[model samples]
Target chain A: MTRIYNFSAGPSMLPEAVLRRAGEDILDWGGSGMSVMEMSHRGKHFGAIAERAEADLRELLAIPPEYKVLFLQGGATAQFAMVPMNLLRDRTAACYVDTGIWSGKAMEEASRYCQVGVAATAKAGGFTTVPPRSEWRIDSEAAYLHYTSNETINGVEFQDVPDSAGLPLVCDMSSNILSRPVDVSRFGLIYAGAQKNMGPAGITVVIVREDLIGKTIPGTPTVFDYKKHADNGSMLNTPPTYIWYLLGLVLDWLKQQGGVAGIEAQNIRKAQKLYAAIDASAFYSNPIDPAFRSRMNVPFRLADAGLEKIFAAEAAGHGLVALEGHRSVGGLRASIYNAMPEAGVDALIAFMADFERRYG
Target chain B: MTRIYNFSAGPSMLPEAVLRRAGEDILDWGGSGMSVMEMSHRGKHFGAIAERAEADLRELLAIPPEYKVLFLQGGATAQFAMVPMNLLRDRTAACYVDTGIWSGKAMEEASRYCQVGVAATAKAGGFTTVPPRSEWRIDSEAAYLHYTSNETINGVEFQDVPDSAGLPLVCDMSSNILSRPVDVSRFGLIYAGAQKNMGPAGITVVIVREDLIGKTIPGTPTVFDYKKHADNGSMLNTPPTYIWYLLGLVLDWLKQQGGVAGIEAQNIRKAQKLYAAIDASAFYSNPIDPAFRSRMNVPFRLADAGLEKIFAAEAAGHGLVALEGHRSVGGLRASIYNAMPEAGVDALIAFMADFERRYG
Candidate 1:
């Protein structure tokens, strides 16, 4: 079977080696007489697997000793609730940056738990650019400052770490984690959903500083409390073992590919190649200001909006799939995550040029 | 590689056919040129897969139209928190039946959101048997009545549906959801973690009556609220796609096995054979009362306590694994979920008899 170049925004392409390795072990993992899916989490095998995954992730991210890496469930959206519940810490309101849909939604969930103060917003730029950090509104006594490091839907990324300045910085890094490196000690907490660059769609990775662990508001559910999860090593209840195992394989693959720096170089090349192709052609356009454009999810619009549907159809016909942009934006998107080989980007660029010539 | 009989409490064995099919498609699924793991949950391929899975499950359980099936995350323990968060409308207390560790934990989580009233307790009996229905203390003004159909850790199951009167009865069938037929109309909500008798360990299946969807406390997080999830079709934010797809395959396997009833017969036979072998041997004993012993999980002890470790090691040598009981309870436990073929049970019995002869 011919494998397609999948450009799905999340749940996008995975390393072919990872998939191949997983398939080989689906029946009997490591001669244990059972699939990884069938192993008990408390068993030594899965326990070791989970430990290796956590250790590998820490090595790749250079997470500080003061950080606790939690392999949590309920996705990053759940973190939107959990962050406020745990980090509000006796304060009534928190500062939020509204770069796009994800951060906006996080603010909405935070509103349910505590008062929300808008620190910055990119809505005036149609969410195609990040608001200038110098102009961000901040409250001196706010509980924490929250932002989205990368907005998957709008394809806008924080250009550099924002200066939270005396306040705890919390970020939702769902769309771009593992595609590049971040200084882990610079922030109080960082969270990412596993579908995009980490692994698959079941687990969420939360890296919280030890100081932020145990402070949930009164009446918070034990499952949502960061302290409880960190205390138990993310096995407060039975964890998503199969997904955790799969994530470990991906981390191992990443380490083989030379860790975060190695993959980041490839990601830069893929984004540059595809973005260069879009810029060279008069028929395709990217709306984000060049500096803030995301290297992971690149959303582009056709010169003729009427051709969007046909463009996606033709792309799929050529073994290219999931290039349709999110419904919120009525154009096309190519999410070139770390797993998307540079060759995949070349394929996408070639298809775009041919389509432009035919329909431009 | 040899496939052995696995008796893990959760994340237990799956059907060989199911595992084989999943392995084959781990690279490219159903000629779609994309692994199911890489597909967008909102895309056409995964949407069809999700639809077919829900339809097959509804057909298997005979769930009524008034109920909506939610494929969720955070496992069943999350549901323990979600149950009280969404169901306790105006009522400040809920009734709970405690049979084992799972039920006991559920009550603990529920107590954070509402006042918890213990209707019955099996702790007095060492959680070996279910408390009789006549002995339960019912609370007239409680929000709802909750019970675990099968306790995974304790190996206890409710023999018959307890009379809930006009109250909405919620059942945690995490360990034995599809192993046998049930009248869906009799309960307001039934939830199962998709590990034991369903699929993998990432997704949780929640079948809630339509009336229970919209109610939650005023401050409930959007992700934890059932109404928001139902409205978004469980794409509230990227449902665990790969686990959900794997579950779809298992649901299809169940259909081919003549749905639940056909598997129920096989389950009964496996339980009877394993139990009989233990009863006939003077060197082994099962503590649960006969009428309420779970067909899915059977825990037993060697008459000589000192031999337990050697027996487990010897059993593993003979291709029988994960027979160690939960740490809370000592001795041995064999979890023969639907995926374990009768041949596996026979192998386990044969292994046990050999161990008894050598070590008795």
Candidate 2:
């Protein structure tokens, strides 16, 4: 069976090993005589699976005891509202940095719950760069300072954590989480959809500092309340059991790849080579500022906009696919997350050189 | 591989055929060179998978044209809040029929959004029966009349839809949605978690009348708003793509089993035989009213209450597992959802007879 190099951002390609393990365990997981999908979330078999997944994630990120790791549903979009709902805690507003589409969406959702302040924005720079931390306006009265570490659509990323200026720091780390390690203690809450670096779609991972929970705004659904989920071990309701199992498999595979540090080295190499290839070609141009270019999603444009579709179509024919950029911005994008192998990038670079020779 | 009969209430047994198909497609789906998990929600490959799944479901239930089907996240627990958030509209109150645990939970959540009036309740009868329709006091001024079609934990199910007193009927069909056909046209909204009769855990299905959406409460998150999801075809954000595909597989398998009508016959036979066995035995008893007994979940008790644990353990030893009842009520339960084959039920009956011979 031929498995192509898939580049669709979020719900992107998983480690082949994880898929193989899942396929093997789909019918009967480890002699339990039940598929992971069929096992009760409260059953001992799944209980062990859930515990190990959380333990491995904690070890990989070095999460502190003061934080609670929750496997929730409704994705980061749910968390967009949940963050303000649970964190607002008698506060009137929260600060957000507008990096690109994702962060803008988060800001808009949060506005429904509380007054949202744009402390820093890259919109003036066409979303190609992150607004400098020095230029951010700190709002002391704000409940928390929020940002998207990487913008999947705009291909912009923060090189380092921005100072929250004493406010609790919250982050939407959907695309770049686990591609590298970060101090978990720095953030009050970090939420991500599992469709990206974690595993697949359906399950969302939320790591929140304990003190920030328990104060959901009135009328918040109990399921949307962090304290309820945290108190219940994220099983406040029957979690997406099979997806959680698959995410556990991905975590197991990640550990085999030398953990986050090991994957980070590969991720850096893959991004650097792909960026260099685009820089060397006159036919292709990436618009993001070099300092802020996302290592996860690399969006680029063909010199002739008309050929973008052809470039993507031909790339798919060569067993490479999902190279088209976000619909909002018409271009080509290659998302090289942790699961994307360096060989995939090398092959893409080679294909680009050949395409340039023919079309230049 | 010894495939045991798993009787989990939800996140319960899936059709073995569906599991086999999923295992086969886990690596490469339909020659797409990507696992269904890897396909972007917007990509054509998954777009087709999503559309066909919805079409098949629509066909199976014979859903009317005015209703929109949404595959959502966060299970029925999320729906408990979303139902009131979206359907309350400009009304300040809604009527709820409290049948059992699930219905009670739905009522508690709805109370957070609006004035919740109990139209009827089975609690007075120890939740062993559905309140007669003649006793129901559904308020004409209330926005809607909500009820649980079946209680997975309480093992209570309504034999027929109750009169909504002309109010829009809203039902939570989580545990028994596809076990039988229902007149979808009668409901303003019907929601179910995919774990039991549909497929697996992770995705929630909402079948809502078009007129019921687009009027969410002031602070409802966009993802929680049915209008936003229905507008985007449940692609408001990346859905649990792989789980959706698996649900499609279950729907495909259900069609092969003769759609809902065919399965309803099997479900009826299974429930009747099991209940008959319980009724004939002096050592076992099911407290739920005969008419209200759930076809999906059967909860029973041992004459010697202390033997309940021993009974469940022995059942597991005989290739039957998860026979223990909900922690709240504590006895024994066998959730024979649509996927639970007739042979499995026969085996369970034989095992029960043998156990009684040994211990009675």
Candidate 3:
């Protein structure tokens, strides 16, 4: 079978090495005679696996000891509700920076729990830019400020971490986590859905500062309570064991790629190649401001909308899959996560050039 | 390596054939270059996988046309809250039967959203017997009646479906789903966590009546909203794709095992042999009433309680792993699901007899 590069916004491409290792161990993890999926969550084997996976993730992200990592279900979408349920207390409002689909979703869910103030919005710019830090309207009485570090749908990214003043800074890093090195100590909490650059869709990784724990509303479900998850080491409910195992393999692969620094260089170069290719041709255009263009998830449009189908079909023929943009924003989106090799970006660029030549 | 029989309450054993087939196909599913975990939820490959998985599940369960099958996350733990959120519709009261740890947890979470009336309790019977239906004090005006058909932790099950009398009858069938046949028409809704007889954790199977659709309160998160999941065909969010794939394999295995009816017979024989061994000896004792002993999860205590550690360690030495009972219940729980062969149960019985002779 011909090799293919998947550019899905989430549930995107994973390193082939991780895939191979996961396949080899799917049925009998470490000769335990049971698939990771079948092992008891409390079994010593899975217990060790879960701890090691979290430890490796901590090392990969340079997470501080004060931060508790939770392996939660329901993805980042669930966190949108959980964040407010856990953090939106003793405050008049929580601030949200609306960049794209995910941030808007966060705000919508938070509104159900507390007053959600729009601290900033690039919506006026058609979501083609991240609002400048100076333009933010943060509330002095805000419980916490929430933002998305990278927007998958609109291909917009906050190039710099916002100054939250005295409030805790929280971010949905779903589409951008592990694409580059990050200072974990700078934020109060960071959550990422695993499907983008981490591992799979079943698990969400939540890193929260220790001081932020133990404040859930009385009615919050146990699984959604960060305090409960941290207290039980993320096995409060039978966690997604197989996904945790797969993520461990990805973390190992990341280490082999010389850690986050090495992968970041490749991700930057790959995104640069695709964006450069799009910029070099009038037939294709990426609308996001260059200053805020995402290193992962580059959404672009063809000059002639009529050729969108042809571009997608021809790309698929060349082993480039899932390059279709999110339906919320109709165009093409190339998600160059850590696993998307430079070679894949080169292939996409080559395909884009050939398509332009044929259609222009 | 000695083959081990896993008696974990959940995150339990799967069909060996299913695990083998899953291992073979983990990296490249049906010639697709990507692992099912890496496929986009909206892509044709995964879309077809999800659709077929649901269709096969509905067929296996004999789900009525009026019931909408939803694949959700967060396990039955989350469903405890979701059940009240979507079904109670701000009603102040609902009726819940307290049978074991699982039912107690359901009530605990449901209490957050509504006034949960304890309709019946098996605790007085040492949590081994199901409350007689005639003694149930279900509030006539409650929004719905909730029960756990099979309690994994306590090894109790309600053999007969309760009459709803125009009220919705919701059940948490987490441990016993797909193990035996049931009348789907009797239930207003049924939700099962996939760790037991289904496939893996992270995916929940929700079969809701068509009338129970779209009643979620305004604050309900989109992921937990039954209406949202039903409207989008359970693709409201990126589901646990690999888990769904494994579940499909399990459904295929169930069909080959003569569907639910065939598996039910095997389960009956397995439970009967194990229970008979315990009852035939003064060395072993099961506290549960014989009439309500679960055919799936058989929890038995020893005549000499001081020998619990010795019994557990000896069993582990023999490769009968995860036989330790739930900490809350403090006894040995042998969860003999559809995957546990009669030979495995016989092995357990033989081991128990030998252990009793040595330790008694």
lDDT of 1 by residue, A44-138 (tens): 88999999999999999999999999999988889999999999888899999999998999999899988899998888879988888889989
Alpha carbon lDDT of residue A333, candidate 2?
A: 96
When 1 and 2 are scored with DockQ, the better candidate is: 2
Better candidate by lDDT, 1 or 3: 1
TM for every model, in the order presented, reads 0.98, 0.99, 0.98
Give the lDDT of residue A129 in candidate 3: 89
Write down the C-alpha DockQ for each prediction. 0.85, 0.87, 0.69
* lDDT of model 1 at position B233: 88
lDDT of 1 at A128: 84
lDDT of 2 by residue, A1-360 (tens): 899998889799999999999989889999999999998989899999999999999999999999999999989999999999999999999999999999999999999888999999889879999877889997999999999999999999888988899999999999999989899999999999998899999999999999989988988888999999999999999999999998999999999999999999999999999999999988999999999889999999989998899999999999999999999987999999989889899989999998888888
- Candidate 2 wrong stretches, greater than 4 Å: none
Best by TM-score: 2
For candidate 3, the per-residue lDDT at B316 reads: 85
Interface RMSD score of candidate 3: 1.6
Docking class of 2: high
Which lDDT values do the candidates have, in the order given?
Answer: 0.90, 0.93, 0.87
Which scores higher on DockQ, 1 or 3?
1
